[model samples]
Structure formats: C-alpha cells, structure tokens
Target chain A: MPQLDPTSFSPQLFWLAIAFILLYLLMSRLVLPRVGKVLGQREERIQGNLEKAVKLKAEAEEVLAAYQKSIADARAEAHSALNQAAAEIAAATAAREADFARKLAEQTAVAESRIKVSKTQALADIRTVAGDLAAAMTSKLTGVTVNGSDAGGAVEAVLKERA
Target chain B: MAAEHHSPLEQFRVEHIGGNLSLGGYDISFNNSALWMLIAVAAITVFMLVGIRKQAVVPGRWQALVEFLYDFVANMLKENVGNEGRKYFPWVFSIFMFVLFCNLFGLLPNSFTVTSHIIVTFALALMVFIIVTAIGFIRHGLHFLSFFVPKGAPAWLLPLMIPIEIISYFIRPMSLSVRLFANMVAGHVMLVVLGSFVLPLGLAGAYISGIVPVAAITAIIGLEFLIACLQAYVFTILTCIYLNDAVHMNH
Candidate 1:
C-alpha cells in the first residue's frame, strides 16, 4: 500500500508533529480553558441555585412551623376564653339566684309575722264581745244584776276549762 | 465507464502542495495529508472559539454541542483514569477531537484520511505507549518491570507466562495503530469499490441495475460514518485503558 511507502513516512511524521503540537497548544492554552471556564461556571451556577433552593425550602418550612405554632396558641387562647366566659356566667347566675332566694325568704318571714299579729287581735276582739254578750244574757234570763268583774271571772274560768 | 478506469486507492495518493521544504536533512513538504490535518485543527479551533463566544449559562445549539463534547471527554477520563486523569484531560480531549474530526472529514468525497495512514496512527499509538510506560516507570521505579510477572502462578509457569505478558505489553502500540488504520482503510476501500460498480454495471445491462450499487454505496457510507465515530471512540477508550494500566499497574 502507499501508506507503507518508506519515503512518505518522514514527511508525514514531520507534518503530523507540527500539526498535532499546534493543535494541542491551541486546545490546552486557548480552547480548553475557555470551554472549561464556561462549563465550570455552569456547574457552579447549578450548584449555587440548588443550594439556594434548599435554603429557601428550609426557610419556608420554618415559617410554616411558626405559623402552625401560632395557630395552636390562638386556638388554646380561644378555648380558655370560652371556658372562662362560661365560668363567669355560671358564677353570676348562681350569685343572682342566691340573692333572689335570700330576698324571697325575708319577704316570706315578714308576711308570716303580720298574719300572726292580725290573728291575735282578732281573737282578743272576739273574746271581749263574747264576754259582754254572756253578761247581758245572764241579766235577761234570771232578771238579776251581774257584775262586770264577776262575768269576766266566769268567762276566764270557762276559757281555762275549755283550754 | 471512467469508474472502472479509476483505482479505488487513488484517493490516498499524497501530492505535494509545492516544492519540498526540508529542515535538518528532512523532507517536510506540505502535502494533502498535512493540508487536511491543518484543516481539521482549524475547524476544531473555529468550532470551539465560536461556540463559547457568547458563553451563556443557558447554551445555544453550538454551545451545547461544545459542552457535550467537553463532558464526553471529561467523563471518559474520570471513568478510566479517575481523578488523576484530570491532569491529562487536554491531551486526551485533543486526541479524541482530532481523530474524530479527521475520520468524519475523511468521509467527505475526495478528502484525505489522515488516520488511514500507518505513520499517523502509529505515531499517536507510539506516543501513548511511550508516555504510559514512562509514567509506570516514574511512579513505580524499577518495580514497573514486575508488571509482566503474574501475581499468582506456579513457579514453573513463570517461564511460559512472563514472555507472553511482555510480548502482549509490547504489542499495544502495534495493535492500537493497526486497528484504527485498518478500519479506516477498509471502510473507505469498500465505499470506493461499491461506488465504482455503479457505472460499469449500468453500461453492462439495464440502467435500473445501477441503483443497486448506488443504494449499497449509500448504505456503506452511512455505516462508514458510524464506524468513523466508533473508531475514534475505540481508539480513545483503548488509550484510556492503557493509561489506566500504566497509572494503576493492576495485574
């Protein structure tokens, strides 16, 4: 084959060295560095973005936790407020009921004392009338005079015997 | 037809560009092979330079292609040579891109295939071999010679195995060079031969018969393109494997 031709080998090698070395220099010095920089920049950017995303996510989670805690606190506060209001209302009602009961007892006691006084007066008036009536009847029936003190003494003895 | 008059090997003929230029008793004339190598280098330089001109974080199409190639070589080195390979990224990357571009460019009609020449491929292979061997020696000193001896073997078998090991180690450059050179030459020769058949077959019989060779040539051309890329990959990975062996010196 022409490739195996001995005379062609040197020239090929000579140019190969020249071309390849130049190419290598171009790559290592200029081309690769620029490409490498861009690639490295992209990777760094991606990594930075990912880290930022993670940080933001963590922050969001923290805020959510705080919000949840606040909600729980508010709920507890509302629950305590409701219980306190119920207790206060119950206490107020109990106090008003007790006051009303005390006032009712006082009014009942006054009414019972007034009824007792009126009954005693009514009994004394009845006793006086009966005594007078008894004296008059005695005088009319026997046609004899009866003394007031004697008639009172007779009514008193009859009342004592009946008691 | 003229197709039958032409030789398939004609394409590989190296013609001088001008008078020979020699230095130190050497003929270093610029030729077709040299011209293609320059073209390949120039093409790569332009491609990379233009690709990164914008340097946008969000890459355009060309930038994406450039980045893809960069990552491709980077990953290859990482996989083969580990972190230590980072230092050699430029060398490995240049080899891959140069070989790949040369192979692809050669597929163009009437273009020279630099890799098809034994001198070029052999030079690349020899450079790799020499460098790798030097690395082994430098890292391990004289202990690098122990690489040929099997770790666990019968004492009697050392007589038989050591030579085989040594021969295989020495055969690396030859194998690497021949594999790439043979593949390129075979593919191109097949394309030419198949293409040459179209005209002669047409003149011999029905014009419709020309379609057969034409279709075959088309198919082979596609296959050649795939092979070109594949050979470049094969060459690079093999270089990596050899480098790995030298760097790590595993049995």
Candidate 2:
C-alpha cells in the first residue's frame, strides 16, 4: 500500500505537527477564552436577574402584608368608633329620660296639692249656701226669723245627729 | 475517466503539490495531506472564530453549535480526568476538531484521507502517549513507573502481572493508531471497490440493476458518516481515559 511506503511518512508528520500546533494556539489563545467568558457572563447575568426577581417579589409581599395590616387596623378603628358612638347615645338617652321623670314627678306633686286646696274651698261654699236657704224658707213660710248663728247652730246639731 | 482502468488504491496516493522541496535532509515535500490538514485547520478556525464574532448572551444557532462542541469536550475531560484535566482542554479540543474535520472532509469523493494513513494516525497516537506519560512522570516523579504494578495482586502473581501490565500499557499507541487507520482505510477501500462496479453493472444489465450497489453505497456512506463522528469521539474519549490513568494512577 502507498501508506506503508516510508518516503511519505516524515512529510505527513511534519504537516500534522504544524497544523496541530496552529490549532492548539488558536483555540487556547483566541477561541476558548472568549467562549468561556461569554458563557460565564451569561450565567452571571441570569443569576443577577434571578436575584432581582426574588428581591422584587419579597418587596411586593411586604407591601401586601402592610396593606392587609392597615386594612385590619382601619376596620378595628371603625368598629371601636362605632361602639363608642353607640355607647354615648345610650348614655345620653338614659340621662334625658331620668331628667324628664324627675320634672314630671315635681309637676305631679304640685297639681295634687292644688286639687286638695280647691276641694276644701268648694266644701266651705256649699255649707254657706245651705245655711242661707234654710233661714229664708223658715221666715217666709211660718213668719219666724232666725239669726245666722242660730241657724248655723241648728244645722250643725242636725248634721251632727245624722252623722 | 470511465475509459481508464480503475484501481481502488489510486485514491490513497499523495502527489506533490506546488513543487518538490526538501528541508534538513527530509523530503518534506508539500502534498495533498498537507493541503488537507491546512484546510481542516482553516475550517475549524472559521467555524469557531466566526461563530463567536457576535458573542451574544443568548446564542444564535451557529454559536450554539460551537458552544455545544466546546461543552462536549469540556465535559468529557471533566468526567474522565476530573478538575486537574482542565489545563489540557486546548490540546484535547484541537485533537478532536482536527480529527473530526479531516475524517469528514475525506469522505468527499476523490479526497485524500489523512487519517487513513498509518503514519498520520501513529503520529497522533504517539503525541497522546508522550503527553500522557510526560504528565504522569512530571506529577508523580518515578512513582509513575509504578503504574504498571497491579494494585491488589499477591506478590507471587505480580511477577506475571507487571510485565503484562507493561505490555498492555505500551500497546496503547499501536491500538489507538491502528484502530483509526484501519477503519478509515477499510471504509474507503470498500466504497471505491463497490463504486468501480457501478458503471459495469449499468452497462451490462438493465440500468435499474445498477441501483442495487448504488443503494448499498448510499447506505454505507451514511454509515461512514456516523462512523466518522463516532471514531472522532472515540479517539478523544480514549485520550481522556489515558489522561485519567496518567493523572491518577491505579484509581
């Protein structure tokens, strides 16, 4: 075979050495370093982006938590305010009712006292009218005149006997 | 071309190109093999350099391909030789790309296959052998000689084991070189021999009969392509394994 012919061997080796050395130099110096750098940079960028995403998500979560807490606080404040207003209204209603009752009691007591005095006056007036009528009737019918005291004493004795 | 008597061996010829020249008593005449090697180198350079011209964060298809090959070799070295093997990446990558492109280019019709030549393959294997051995010695001093000694063998068994180990270790270059050379030579020879039959068959019988060998050649060509890739991978991976052995003896 032509391959076994020793004459061709050295030249082949020579060219191979040159080609191989050239390739090694190119790859080691030029190609591989750049490729590695690019890959490393991409990886770093990806990692940075991931970290940023995580940070943003955490911030969002914090804001949500704060928002929920504020909502709860507002609800609690509103409830307390409503309770306080209701309590105040109840207290005012109770005070107003007590004042009205006290006033009504005072007016009721005055009216009762006035009715008692009127009742006594009406009784006195009735007694006088009865006395005069009795005196006038006796004089006209039997021609007997009676004094006020005599008639009063007679009415009292009759009133006392029937009592 | 059809009128000429065809010899399948003609393809293996390495005729002088440009002119005959000698350097230091060796007839280092430029030949097709030399041209092809330069072509392979140029192709590799362009593939890598142009691919990364953009150096994009998100790679385009060409850049992705380049990166994929880079990662493939890098991972192989890592898996085989661990972290210390990192320094050897350039050499391994160059070897892989060089062999791959040469094999692929050789598949072109009427092309001279560099790897098919025994001397070329032997040279590559020798290069690997020398590097691996040198590394072993440099790292471990004379302790590298202990590589031939079996780890757990009985003292009596070692007498037999050591020489055998030595022999097997030395056989590496031959095995590595011949494997690549034989595969390439056989494949090309078979292709040419079958191809020579095509015109005769077509002229002798119905033209349709010629399609049989043609179909076979087509299938085998496909297989050859696969073999080319596989061989390149094998060559590189074997280099890694050898490097592993040298870098860490016995374990």
Candidate 3:
C-alpha cells in the first residue's frame, strides 16, 4: 500500500467544480425557468376560467330573472283580458234582456188597452234610471262625460204623468 | 503481513482520461469521482423516466412514489423559498436528486463514495456559492455589497464588523463542502474499519470476537446508510439557504 499523502492538492477538484458550475448554469437558466413559466401560465389560465364561469353564471341568472318576469307579465295580461271579455258578455246579455222586457211590456199593453199609458210611463222611467246609473259608473270609473239632462227630463215627465 | 492488509479506500484515485493530456503537470482524468457522478445522473434519469412514463390519474405503486417525491420537493421549495422561489424549484430539485443518488449509490457493496471526496462536494458547494453571488450582484449591482455590512451595528464597530462578515461570507463554500465530505468520509470509514475487524477476528481463531465485530459492522452499516441520506439533505438545505441570500440579498 502506498503511503497516504495528506498535503497533496488534487487538481481534479478544479475541473469538477468547473463542470458542476456549467451544469448548474444550464439547469438554472434553461430548465428551471421554463417549468416555472408553465406553472404560472397554468395558474393564470385556471383563474381566468373561474372568472368566466362566474360571469356566465351571473348572466344565466339575469336571463332567468328576466324570463320569470316576462312570464308573470304575460299571466297578468291574460287574466285582465279574460275579465274584460266576461264583463262585455254580461253587459250584452243585460242589454238583450232589457230589450226583451220592453217588447213584452208593449205586447201586454196592446192586449189589455186599459193600462197602456201607465205601462209606457213605467217603462220610460226604468229606461231613464238605467241610463243615468250607467253614465255615473262610466264617469267614476273612466273619468268620462256623464250628462243628466235628457235622463232627468224624461224621468220627471214620467213621474208627472203617473201623479 | 501488515503491509499486505490494504485499505479499501485505495480504490479512489485520479487517472488520466484517454491517457494523453498532461497540461502544466496536471492529469485531467475521468476518475472514480467522475464515474460515480455519471452513474448518479444516469440513475436519476432512469428512476424518473421509468417511474413517471405511465402517469395515471389513479397511479400505480411506482408512479405514486414518484409523485410523492415530486410533491415533497415542490412543497418544500414553496414553504422555504416562497412562491417566487418556486421558479427555481427544478434546479433545486435536480441538485437534491443528484446528491441523493450519488449518496445512495455509494452505499452499495463494493461501490465508491463520490461525495466523500472533497473535490466533488466542493464542486457542488462552489456552484451554490457562485450562482447565489451572481444573482445578488445582478439583482442589486454595487448595492448588493451592502449585504456583508449588516444593518443595526454601531458606526464605530464598522471596521471590525466588516471583516468578520467578509470572513463568514467567504466560508460559505468551505462550510458547505466540509460538512458533506466530512460526514460521508467519516461514516464510511467507520463502517469499513468495523467490517475489517470481523476479518481480523476470524483469522485470529476467535469465533466469539467475530460475533461482536460482525454485529457492530451490521449496525454501523445501517447507520452509514442513514448518514448517506442525511448528508445529502444537509447539502441541499445549505444550497437553499445560499439561494435565499441571493434571491433576497438580505444577508
């Protein structure tokens, strides 16, 4: 066995250091930074996707609310139209009944001949009262004209003849 | 007989590469140190490639192990170096793997301890030193010199403090290299010496003495294996510290 020499300076250390430094530089400059860039880019993309999802969710919610509101408006409009049709039907039926009653009363007067004047007076009063009530309701409900002169004069003439 | 008993450490020597170049009386050779270094790199490459080639969402056993190591190093860098430090994780990770591979390879039967040599450890330490120093200068320029002169010291103590700081700054590579080399060399030497005792006992016709030496060698070998890993850890952690100084230029 050769005697160990402690004082000897090993030159291999110098070359090894050089090689290591070169390798370290390669790793630091080339490899590491590229990986880091990829990771950072991935994180940014994920955040951007999350933001898009949130925006999309908000937009979907807004669309949903708008759709619900329009549906409610359509329901209300349908209900009002149905009520107006029913009211018109009732008014038409009542007008038809009034005409029928008037004709029947005229026929009764013709058949009897004794109370013809009283029956005509009573029929005129009933028609005048109905006109006045309709005009008042129209004026109150729709802010429209409700004239009383013609109805009042007829009603008063009928009452005087009866007296 | 005494001379016939040769130490196993004699295997490590500097030899000329291609047996030709002799520049300024220095033989530039690919020695045991270089051989082990190449082996370390090859081992790491094989391990990583083989372990990660078939990456599954539900990973196999080997893939799981590789992912665990990757996450361990990544998390360590994130915790110690911060988010910005994550940028340098690959380099740090490479250093760790290379050192760990070399250390583990050295522990095999009849294998050379590359890290036990001062040259290899010094090379690694010098790299950490140079990179950190360069980063400091690049980041701060002339102002980075102020790192040696710590803040909060009295102006009257500037002269004394400056030299102390400079000495300590210069000692970074020395401490880094010495810590790893000394630990590796000492641990391996102890194991070898203990193992040799078993041979001597057997030759002396003392079977009882052989038992103690054999048990001691076994225990020492186990301890040396642990030391191998520990030295690598120490080297990597020191590298991180040095890098922190560069990135922050705080010291």
Predicted model with the maximum TM-score:
1
Model 1 residue A143 lDDT score: 79
Candidate 2 vs candidate 3: which has greater lDDT?
2
| TM-score of each candidate structure, all chains considered together | 0.90, 0.81, 0.63
How much is the lDDT of residue B59 in candidate 3? 58
How far residue A129's Cα lies from its native spot in candidate 2, in Å, is 16
DockQ of each: 0.65, 0.58, 0.11
Give the 10-residue window scoring lowest on summed lDDT in candidate 2 chain A.
Answer: A122-131
Q: Cα lDDT for residue A97, model 1?
A: 100
Over A1-163, each residue of candidate 3 has an lDDT whose tens digit, in order, gives 1112332224456555544555556445654444444445556878899999999999999999999999999999999999999999999999999999999999987877757777888787776776697668778998988678764665567667988
Better of 1 and 3 by TM-score: 1
| Superposed model 3: Cα runs more than 4 Å off | A1-11, A14-163, B1-5, B14-25, B203-206
lDDT of 3 by residue, B1-251 (tens): 45444564553444344544445666555555566666776566566657656544455787666666666667766766677677677777877777777788878877776777776777778878888789889878998889988899999999999999989999999999888877877777677777778877977875777788789878878887788778777777777777777778765
> How would you encode candidate 1's per-residue C-alpha lDDT over A34-73 as one tens digit per residue?
9999988989999999999999999999999999999999
Better of 1 and 2 by DockQ: 1
The pairs that clash in candidate 1 are none
What lDDT does candidate 2 reach at residue B150? 88
